[model samples]
Target: MSSIRGARVAALSAVVVAAFALSACSGGATDDPPASAEQTLRLSAQAPPSSWAIGNAPGGDATMYLSVYDTLLRTTPDAEITEGLAEEWEYNDDLTELTLHLREGQEFTDGEPVDADAVVASLNVSREGPSTATNLTAVSDVTATDESTVVLTLSQPDAALLPNLADVAGAIGAPDVLTAESSTLEPVGSGPYILDSSSVAGSNYVLKKNPDNWDADSFPFETVQFQIIADPTAITNAMQAGQLDWIALNTPDQLAQFPEPKYTSGSNNANGLGVLWLADREGTIVPALKDVRVRQAINLAIDRESIAEKLQVGSLHPTEQVVNPNGGAWSDELNETYSYNLEEAKALMAEAGYADGFAVTMPSTFLSTPYEPTFSQQLGDIGIQVTWETVPFQDFLTKVFSQNYGMYFMFNAFRSADSVDVRGATTAIFNPFNSTSPEYEALIAEANSSESADAFAPVNEYFVKEAWFAPIFYTAGPWVASDKVTYTPAKTFYPSLKPWAPAN
Candidate 1:
């Protein structure tokens, strides 16, 4: 993984230097403009927008949501938070109240003022919306104290609140459009671009640059078109044929097709925490998983390093903890605690009175994983019968949240304004439905109350000790783009176009 990443960095640096030289020698010629000077950007996207409303859109489709609406706070590709719609924000000493000062002189696409009242309405809508409601669980009330100031009062001291607001929850909408039923179809926002009415739903979307937008100069492109292409092969074909300017490659095989010079590629540490959900820990649905020994055995059954090497295509870092490796809460000791030991795993299963093994069902979204067969084989060796079920990505979430399966595979990379916010990641996975341990809850409360990384270490340790989750890896992937454009990937699961610029 290190070698692959090093080569990508070296190649990207060369491409950037060449781009700068070409720009310097151009002499501001408008007649013989560079290929990138064709400002209309056509890109490929994996997830199509379900609705025009930012709050209703799936959280994973950030590329679409961010193109239509701007958040109160903007997160850079390097994971640094900067001002967006809001000029500044501060939390009270007790950490229960948060105040946001909106940037004056800004207006929504509908010519409405981007004031505190608009922000308050937008946030309240988000709080009731499906996409952001779970993240804003700690929020109690939102109020507009003044013309340009909005205050959010939380029921508890939530360390993840700011980060949650930085996501879809903080996207401010036009007051008039906020109550309209067609807001999901025809949206009004204060973002750099406005959704064009000519856009064809599901197939493609066109966004025209908003002339009144404050950050219009930074966007550069006059028009941006997003083409929905879920198939990897189709996306690669579109890029090769010059129909698409940018796309993300989930595997190294897809990335290898786009060579350097003609294409510039870069990678970011995936904010993702790949985990296995053993939902029936109490044996209400699956009797075998009730024993602690059985759960511990399940943890040691699979070889995560091998999975990363083969399935991840040198793009992931094998991990045992939920916190990202870049974050301060990550612990090397916890990562090494559950080393792969098939013999021990089998022994533990036998000790738990499962010598004859029990039948269990595992649900998956993808057709297969690099180590899926091996994972099942290992369990079979310990007398556990395995059954596999496949479902769509949307249905996958519904099943997990409804607790409809015994075990399932999932990944989460919840990002907030604070780059080191471990609480955001932990809370995203171990919510009320999934986690019921009182000791773990107490540790989480203590960690969330403190601003120090050392305080959160114990919570991560507790997650590992209790075998709450079997974390597989820290995933990362390449963002492949034509040399006509220079692109930087965001440090989040969902891709955003904010970091892309013309190569010239």
Candidate 2:
């Protein structure tokens, strides 16, 4: 969404796939070092971190970025705001301004002081970055008030700012490293670990403890290695072979094999559950989709429960909304809002004057195909035929935003009301046509106006009733770890290097 026309979208390729679905670095204090600091926290990554640019370490590079850079704030497993690099923080009475006091004696790996000026520089680059720009949408200015003090002026009270800081949007890169010629592939950060020379760019990454880390004792691993394994079978084999402490399990069979007491499982309702996004709400590319009845008809055609039972292996729950059931913005009333009814869908299609059906072109990728068959076939039966133009995984994001397709599939993390708005709002990248009605915009405004999660309840209901997203189900992301590696799954969708402690 940040300057797609600027072609900065090319910078976003590494962060998609498994990386986008993972969220949160839940804030915690390890008062005591792990039982064994000499242990290595070996984990399987679905994708690899390919960039070291500021605010560029989202998606697969999230943990890698977290390892190399320290965010100003940290989020706990509860999704509560806490401290990371900054020891203290405060907001003005109106909540438009925020001040951060960094921890003393901290410096970047390149020997530059981790001061307010460095933070301001990093924030400046991030304000226009592909991912961070959207996160800092409310910030009007960032200033270095003092050596350890940084202040932010906001255009409005952004409820998502604090949590965003805990995520990739908060990563503070060393100014010198950021400007270096090779920094794109090489990083210079002040986090708990540093990238080892033996590390390969895409295959494997080996990180060693930062000799000068301010909170050296806080992290449990002395060394960490992330293996890029794409196949679920390979990840499962790696875990069984003791090559991995945990795995980003993919298939239901993989999840089932890693049974209870021996292996601990953690899951959160991720946004990747085959959400069928109707991008051409204005009917720029597909005229029939412009009609509200046509859109509602599509929602009725999806057999969400079947997708959950047959494809998802009953490990996940089916639904019609994108909100995480555990989050405050979730509403039980909206979950089963659309029941599978082909006849009803046909009637709506006929009422919209498309009784004979219309053909549409759609973008698909390696990641989206598994969920395609049912969605495409169900629509076909109702006279709405889909023509998929499969693109490489790397080209998928750019193709969708190019406005070349009327519909596509997307996977993202559902953290708050802001998360939903970025995709549904008129300005969101997902809404290529920027289509919206006064009533829909009004609900969005009301939701953003209030910090209370309750306000978003209406917005969630509105999208479901309007059939903005034919979300097949409320999907869950499950991780399998050895019993010896116990962990607390934060409200965040992904686990970074911080949570893995050496089991007693």
Q: What lDDT score is found at residue 379 in candidate 2?
A: 90
List where candidate 1 sits over 4 angstroms from the true fold. Answer: 1-38, 253-256, 367-371, 392-394, 414-432, 453-455, 490-495
lDDT of 2: 0.68
Clash-forming residue pairs, model 2: 19-59, 23-493, 23-494, 26-75, 26-76, 27-75, 27-76, 319-473
RMSD of 1: 7.5
Candidate 1 per-residue lDDT, tens place, 285-325, comes to 78877787888888898688887786656566788887655
lDDT (Cα, tens digit) per residue for candidate 2, span 1-504: 100000111111213543343222221234465567787777756566646788665452366677888888876655567788889999888778999999989989889898899889888888888766777888999999889999999987766778777767788888976656677778888888998899988888899999687877778788888777755567668787778776544334656777777787665334233467887988898888788899999999988778777765634467677666666766777776678999999999999999999998877776567777877899998988888887876777577668888877665444533443333233445676777889876776666557685666776787888887777654444566777665544443333455567777
TM-score of 2: 0.89
Question: Which portions of model 2 show Cα errors greater than 4 Å?
Answer: 1-33, 251-272, 416-429
Scored by CA lDDT, what does every candidate get? 0.64, 0.68
Clash count, one per candidate: 2, 8
